[model samples]
Target: MPQFSRHSRRGRILIAIGLGALLVGTSACTRIRTHQGYQVDKLLVDSVQPGIDNRASVEGTLGRPSFVSQFGEKDWYYVSRDMRALAFSSPKPVDQTILRVRFDPAGNVVAVDRMGLEKVANISPMGATTPTLGRHRSLFDEIFGNIGAVGAAGMGGGSGGGAGGGPNGS
Candidate 1:
């Protein structure tokens, strides 16, 4: 074999180190993360028996519901969701569950319903442009909209206290 120069060997080592570091950095940047919401324990939820468990017992078991019904106080909802996403990407829902517990007028649990991701609905907006009452102005209109609206002295009645001639000006 042929002997390699010290400088050439050092350069090759540096290049290998740089390539290794680049691979590590890129892999770290593209890492995916899993996020969870509302630690809803299935066992605890199951332990809550309808008609037997009241609002107090249910709350004690599965903790408070994520939110109550907007129309009435008889419905309680627990929302649990798992999201996964890569770096710099919007999180996508991997799993979701909505636990609905209906209470009777006497505050006793009447019904328990568990809804899974199958019930998830992806609602897209009707149009890309949102409906607005006023007219939409362009970038040029915005930048120059107030250009002529102001006077050379800045605020019209200002005593030449703008630009190069202000209270703190030279």
Candidate 2:
């Protein structure tokens, strides 16, 4: 009957609209995964041997390192991170790897060390103001405190005189 068909059409349209809304909502909340820094290859990493592999061989195998030590013995660092984020939130590290290759004076590999997220440190700043050792002054005190300090007493100016003594320096 015509009445039955009309109701069926309406139900189908409502179902389609509901499905479309659900698809969009889920897409918005989908997590975005990203990789940063060096990409490690297990086989290549395993091939590198201490003493046997020199700086040139290691560089050829792993490419350039992320950073090198600034002081003390020369060391190369390969840092990697896997991050994930949802919606408009900032990305957070899901996994991290820090590979350190130590080198001797002769540029030969001394040791190879690998570290995970356990070594990561989180630091939170105390507040907006930095703690400093000094006397605290109010707004009014800071503004007017030094008003008369310019030429006052042993400030190296006015009354007590200049280089040769007196006001004329004679």
Candidate 3:
């Protein structure tokens, strides 16, 4: 009976340790959900009507917009994003909404447009360094290349102070 009890206790301890490890592992891998920018309320968004809703009414309904157009036609943008990320990873957009309200010169709503994740652009950098129009220079060239070029040629007429004449004017 004593031997059996001892074996059972050891088995229980092992099972408890295994379960703890599993719980910790799963918690580490669990995704973190985040919301950014404007929070959308379906009822409130639906209430905004073109022509009937002016700038003041739209602002009261949706609060402040995320951004307003700087040039060309006047437009208000309300952007929202739902993101998810695992441990130490960059957050990726799971869903996105961009609501645009176009206005006429009188500041009355002309059109209301809603866009989803289909309009989202995923841009990746082409390379480590941006391409430029010039000769490729080495680290040493960039650092020390301009050492003697400062006073050379058209650069202030060498060191004569004026033209090719010296201090005494040749």
Residue-wise lDDT of candidate 2 within 25-128, one digit each (tens)?
99999999999999999899888899899999999999999999999658999999999999899888899999999999999999999999998787778989
What TM-score do all the candidates reach, one by one?
A: 0.64, 0.81, 0.81
Report, for every candidate in turn, its global Cα lDDT versus the true structure: 0.84, 0.91, 0.92
Output the lDDT of residue 128, model 1. Answer: 75
Candidate 3: tens digits of C-alpha lDDT, residues 1-170 = 99999999999999999999999999999999999999999999999999799999999999999999989648999999999999879999999999999999999999999999998789999979888998999999999988978878876635665644876764
Model 3, C-alpha of 37: deviation from truth (Å): 1.3
Ranked candidates, highest TM-score first: 2, 3, 1
Q: Provide the lDDT at 63 for model 2.
A: 97
Candidate 1 lDDT tens digits, 1-170? 24568778989999999999999988877847575657878888889888799999988888878999998889999988887777788777888889999999999999999998898788778867878898689999988888756654546754565466765775
Show where candidate 1 strays beyond 4 Å: 1-11, 34-36, 125-128, 131-170
